[model samples]
Target: MNTLLAEPGTLTTSPIRTQQPTGPRIEVTGRMHDRFDEILTPEALAFLADLHQRFAGRRHDRLADRMRRRFEIGNGRDPKFRDDTASIRSDATWRVAGAGPGLEDRRVEITGPTDRKMTINALNSGAKVWLADQEDATSPTWANVLGGQISLFDAIRRQIDFTSPEGKAYTLTTGDMPTIVMRPRGWHLVEKHLTFIDSSGAAMAASGSLTDFGLYFFHNAQALIDSGRGPYFYLAKLESSEEARLWDDVFSFSEQHAGIAHGTIRATVLIETLPAAFEMEEILYELRDHCAGLNAGRWDYIFSIIKNYRGRGARFVLPDRSDVTMTVPFMRAYTELLVKTCHKRGAHAIGGMSAFIPNRRDPEVTARAIEKVSADKKREAGDGFDGTWVAHPDLIDAARAEFDAILGDRPNQVDRQRDDVEVTAAQLLDVHVGRAVTDAGLRDNVSIGVRYLESWLRGIGAAAIDNLMEDAATAEISRSQIWQWIHQDVRTDDGAPITRDRVERILSDLLSTVERFDGDRFDDAADVFREVALKEEFPTFLTVGAYSRFLVDLA
Candidate 1:
């Protein structure tokens, strides 16, 4: 094996030169597993190398701009709509490429990692769409990254059925399968297993966004188009119209290179970030040729608010993680604005996730999940949303029933055109600080954060903790609220001040009491939770810091 250090603070992968006959110099640093070469084909890797060469600089620039914007916002710069992009917002002449075949009636969508079992379950889940998430729901391990692609490949080709080690067999249900809309990792992440070496003799980690998208698009675009569904995606973690533009360019280029027609790909943008909420119209306009719709990702949206306004005083601070529901004033403003904006532009307005997963062993837990999911989906359907998300397959029928009642025979209510809804900047920034913070809430946050991190380090991104499906975004919220409470000097309902010592004591106590599972890395997870939540300077994203430390360790 050969490894070379490239730059300061950059991960250097060790790769042995394998079979080489491609467009550019690229090396696979990860240990090759069963059928991994099928997805990491020479031609596919070359395609990714070229994408990196042409667009990596812009990705870095956009990420840098994000940092600058966050710093400015921390120093009292209000995050509102800009005067520069008013024309795009006002122009009503242009519309997106809209939903293509198999994507028209998305009343219910299931989200999960793209492992083999999940791939089979999601396709058979009776939902209209499957968000094959390679981001927050995936742990980004080398084996996992390759395994997900292989699973998708086989599933797309109708050859994914298999028997388990315990003799249980799994197969796709004989029905209209859910359309696969893959969600790549955000631009901020790097795929350390593959190093892209340019002509200048510099080798850097490949972009996780490009790596995931490139491999999937290269191998599946033509196959999907042949099936009349086309290549669809759910673009996550977009912060600006410029980032959206970059994706559009990538889509256009991929289409031409694959011999597919322009507008053959449809992408739904997740308006999850605080900055993204302000530039919704601009983002849609930028990706109009390939845009399908916009999804309201509530967990990350809340995390974004806490992250950007972390130091703006007690007014900007948040309550407990559980208390910050979708019914809050600011959250209400976000959903209302999303539906209004999307409908006005002839785009679908999708609702956020209902994270309540079912527990079969406990019927009461399952009952609550059904009740909560049914109510949430009803609210979204009544509010003019075209569809919604559920974490577990068991909750799909409950969610679909709500949409079926409202939608009736119509595919979507995009024509609703919520003209009566007019959201203002004040409403968007209107933080209703209540006295709901409690000792239980603080300890819950600590417990959830550490447990989730432990699971993530063990190569599981989606974990069921306390009967709810937890993802990276939820963990980010948990840790961020701890940081916000500590910095804002927030007190619980019982008059306990949130300080570093108090938080650490609670974290330490939870380590012994929290239930243990296989691959428990509590000590490491606690260290990471402490660094991100208890440190004075707020970390932009827990995954970012944790990935660098644990996921890509040299050891």
Candidate 2:
């Protein structure tokens, strides 16, 4: 067998180098981008044409200004909430002072989606909040749609416990559940099917876009609020602080128009976009008064990083997908930023969902997975994340158990009473885009760029290589890109299985070096790597990036 094959970058799906559009893409006022691009491919010409059609005569500034006024951002601060402090601390520069109490005293609240009956039961259970998701977890067709809507109504009417739509006996006793939350689809195809059930199997509503979804959601929330129900939403795919800010403004307007208090509405922003990572603090500030918390939205964020950046070339510079590290320095930087930011403002730092689905067919597999996920959740909770989301019902017990075990009976154990941490544009740029790297290390360094540049954009912070955060001062240079190119040969070195242990060791060593400078925090982080090492038995964990595990494995 040949020792060297084509570079990951060279493996193109198409023969031609497709044209792609760059940033600041246009959006036609009151129109969906998908509508204009339905007939075009993702190439340059299509993107350019779409850009022309979408932004040629639109007034984006008008929208931005309208949103600013609506949200009442007086002098760069959301009016509803006063800043606790005037200045934010620089990254990782503060000393540990002394070892604080074990974070196990803190707690996170999760609202899991059991079967519709179980879901309703979970909602009314003592969990802090439950998000009824309409995307990702649900099948895109009909049954789930009806089930989702009915579940919402049932929860509102206090009728969730009886039998499921399928007629199995189930119910939610009042005192045990958390507050109900709705995670609806974006301005995507699902909205059309949901808002208007077509008698002839055709949607009566216009195909919804992101803006349209907001309009629809706000309208429904207004109705609910008028009827004395809560008006809260979990905003997913937040691409930037500006976007989250936009939602804040929308929420405020909706409340005012509905004759409710301006800050009555709450939103939890999902950092699913690459751009949102960098502006996380700003996004949080924009929505702080009404923010439930922030989620480390992993799958979509990774997909965005690949599509927006790496999709330009055919072959990836990084070895196999499994070679990438979430426990790397950039990710640590992002997580640490989130924890500190949340702590500074008295908001919760909710970890992302865990992707490890227990194999029910194998008891041993399931047990090991539960134990590993339990440990991970503990570490995250210990690190200050208040809660996490889970995809499967089986994992819910483990997740909640970890949280309950960690939190016990403390009422205000979560330090939600603090001043806002001020971070400058230059300071942010220094952590992400300002970092320098040579062309020779573009591939490996791309992850650094992804974490610093993209994560910031996603409002998540810089989630990248381990060495990047080893010092008190931020590095202007990115080693991941350079490291990738230099280590490219080693990645493809013959006959090495891309096992969990290998990836764990690589990340552990790298993270160890970064954590060394910070003392106990580094030692505490080892438990996460140990959990990752245990995931070798689960192959799916490797393929899908298992990003949720990184967040949920907080214990």
Candidate 3:
């Protein structure tokens, strides 16, 4: 049996015998090393196989529904609260099972990837909750995917620590630690390293969400419960209530299989897509038993709007990304509606990310950035948000200070119901409130998009650009906005109409200036950027194609 174990970066064509009952046969399709065997043990693989076999079809159906809905919207259908679920919203007595263990106070949550260094630092970052992100903040390299699981397993047991190459040591501090809430990759991604052969002899790639959620929950759920924490999660990129329902089903099955109580898992859904913004009530209702709350997720929301309505003409043409502030009528409607819906359902209303990273050398710049972040947090807290997100440790205090003032001696401000905030579908769909497009904005978009793609290809998902920490969300918006502008022939502030030629010229100029640390990876990044941005058919996600082309494990 030991001799049959496959080497790292090599696929095992045969399934290993396990004690579990007959089902899908699990095989490792990538190289297995560095404790990967521990996490991918026969028992764990059996559990994942169970989940994949049970839910993979539903996942595919939901993804198909997404495409159908997008097609309808592009053809002039408007999104609104579903009439079928209207009673779920109108019935004032029902509410979600709120704030399970360690999640009562999320005043200053910090988010980062789950690498060793980030795991240690985020736990000790003095924030109330650390969003141990396996989604946007992480590049799904095989090493990263397995390494993150190992890191989280160790962290839960207080056995995690790190040291720099220069010999500086880091360890978990002896005090109250930030509660861990894992964010798995969206449902669209697949873990190609893991394969499941069904009874029909056909094989399929494992869902990244299930792999991340299953591995972490199987290995650490009981341990976290023993340590007074539950298996908490932040659900990303869900576009409809049906997706939320699917997650709820997964959570129930996982908990029952693990012998944990039915409601042991709690999830905060990110209302990041336009369709989801209209279905917040339905989403929370579907997952009410396992729901913790909803997050504003402004970046992806903007990207989703552009992706869905780019071909709808001038009314949906958005201006510069910078000018599209939360105060804009459309954005305000989205956030306010989220807060109202969450509070109405007896859940927390968390604000969007303050992606500012403080620069020690430039005191003046840091001060200005902090001020802007503080103002944003203040607005959220004032508008009834219970907590907000910050990307760096330095900005945690500033975010906390704002929520702290409103929350006072309270864990959260869930009681502050904004009943006066009545948002309509028309208001939420209004995209004409922001400033017009500009050439400078176009250049910035191309430059940042290229830089982020280069880093992503090099296995870095989060990069600090112009003093702000950017993840895949930022790059998604950048390239998405460019695509929308070209599709609409949007006129810049200088009255120059955007065209494929203009975009190509700008992309070429930006690529020339991009000095990537990863040598030749930039060439691949450039090709991918052009494919996603300039193609007639908009790709669902840039990462999907790029991941298969570059990040796949090689022998």
Candidate 4:
């Protein structure tokens, strides 16, 4: 039970010691650098240990439920809205906690990893909110995990600035900084660098969600409240309303522990999973006191569809990744249902991300990008969405303009009840209505999947592939599509059937092309790609396995 704190400006490589007799003995296995002690204080570790001890078993049970549900779906059981929660959905009088403090006007939000450079630029971006992402946008290297926390702490206090290797300086502006909303990792991932050992000497990895949320909440929740902004969060990859209830309970406990008001923390849930699309109202009900809104996470939504239905025959097979736009029939149903359900519950209905990164040199390409973004935003605004996400700062203007046109002086369009939109489970599951599969599309998937995985292995999560900012969502869709295509023996327009040998050939070709820039990571990325894409059983998430084998080695 010896707890030691490192002095300022020094790294503490030794493991942190915890002394509580009944609590788990928490240890920080990651190498501690400068300022690490400020975030990983003994008190914070104890708090996180309490969180794990109380909730870890429930988390495990919920994950097991996810597996059982997936099994039922694979065995020909159609997923419908849960009969048990029908009353929750029908109770329309209840509403989530409306927007609070800095979250009032989130017409445009820029999302990226919390690297020092991004931290500065995103705050300076004219968008109304900055989704400081710790999930898909960040590699789970120990340095990134700790460094992101440090950068966020500095940013909240307006003490964050960075100098490049060439001596160029970057600083924040004085006024109109975007509101910060942190997104923690999904339930499936674990933070291997942190360990909790029980009395019997059994050791288990810490949950990434708790590790990210606990550290941030412990260090900055009070500071944010003092600054007139409450702690806000964006929940990702939640598959059920029960998971939302778990988060609500965590928020309640955290508020009580921090001496804050019970409903001070506001969270926006991302309706990214296929199952979650069916339970939007129930999700909002579960988190009604803490919920701010729901987002249509398009990329991961598609990924979830593929993961859940890959072996369900040709009816569930999707076309090329590029073919599934927001305007597709099934996607439109999901988005419309989201807006309807959210507005019905008096919660904001946020739109999907526009991943197009502006290319300055090519005016023609830039014009097309702007046009594409403008159309997407306009559609969302017209559909009664309250806000939208942009990956780059440059696309903010286009998104803002569209939302502005629809909103005028209003902060949001949550009052626009989309009663005309009725989405059945059959419509939401309609995946075979989009564009046709093509040989070129298959090649693009292989190339992008390999290239993104290589970058992720090199500790970069978001990579620009062909002018689009691609994150884990991009790679997930790419690899999952490949797996689905091979499982269905899908034939491309070029008259060739998708086989493992053909996919292997494409992987080799892509590997050779990527090897020049990818270095050693190319081999590792290829191995991971083969395992996730070619195996008879699809891996739940590529990052789950890759993080343990590659990123943890960095520690």
Cα lDDT of model 1 by residue, 429-483, tens digit:
8878574788998998998999999999999999999999999999999999999
- Return the clash pairs for model 4, or none: 1-19
**166-196, model 2: which lDDT tens digit per residue?**
8777666565345555665542222222122
lDDT of 2 at 6: 16
Task: Please list the residue runs of candidate 4 whose C-alpha ends up more than 4 Å from where it truly belongs after superposition.
Answer: 1-22, 199-201, 518-520
Return the TM-score for each candidate structure: 0.95, 0.52, 0.95, 0.96
Q: lDDT values of the candidates? A: 0.88, 0.43, 0.87, 0.87
- Clashing pairs for model 3 are 8-31, 8-32, 9-31
lDDT sort, best first: 1, 3, 4, 2
lDDT of each residue in 1-555, candidate 4, tens digit only: 223322222223333334323436566767767888888886788778778877887888889989998998889887898899888877767888978798988899999999899999999988889999999999989888889999999999999999999998999985878889999998888998887765465778889999999999989999999888889999999999999999999999999988999899999999999989989988998899998999999999999998899889998888888788888888989999999998898888899897777888888778888898999999999999999999988899999999999999999988888888888999998876656799999998888888899889988889998888899998999999999998888999888999999999998888666637525588898899998888898899989988888889324
User: Relative to the unseen true structure, what is the C-alpha lDDT of residue 197 in candidate 2, on a scale of 0 to 100?
Assistant: 18
Give the higher-lDDT candidate: 1 or 4.
1
Candidate 1: segments with Cα more than 4 A from true spot = 2-24, 553-555
CA RMSD, predictions in order: 3.5, 17.7, 3.0, 2.9
Estimate the lDDT of model 1. 0.88
Local error of candidate 2 at residue 55 (angstroms): 15
- Angstrom error of the Cα, residue 407, model 2: value is 3.8
Flag clash pairs in model 1.
none
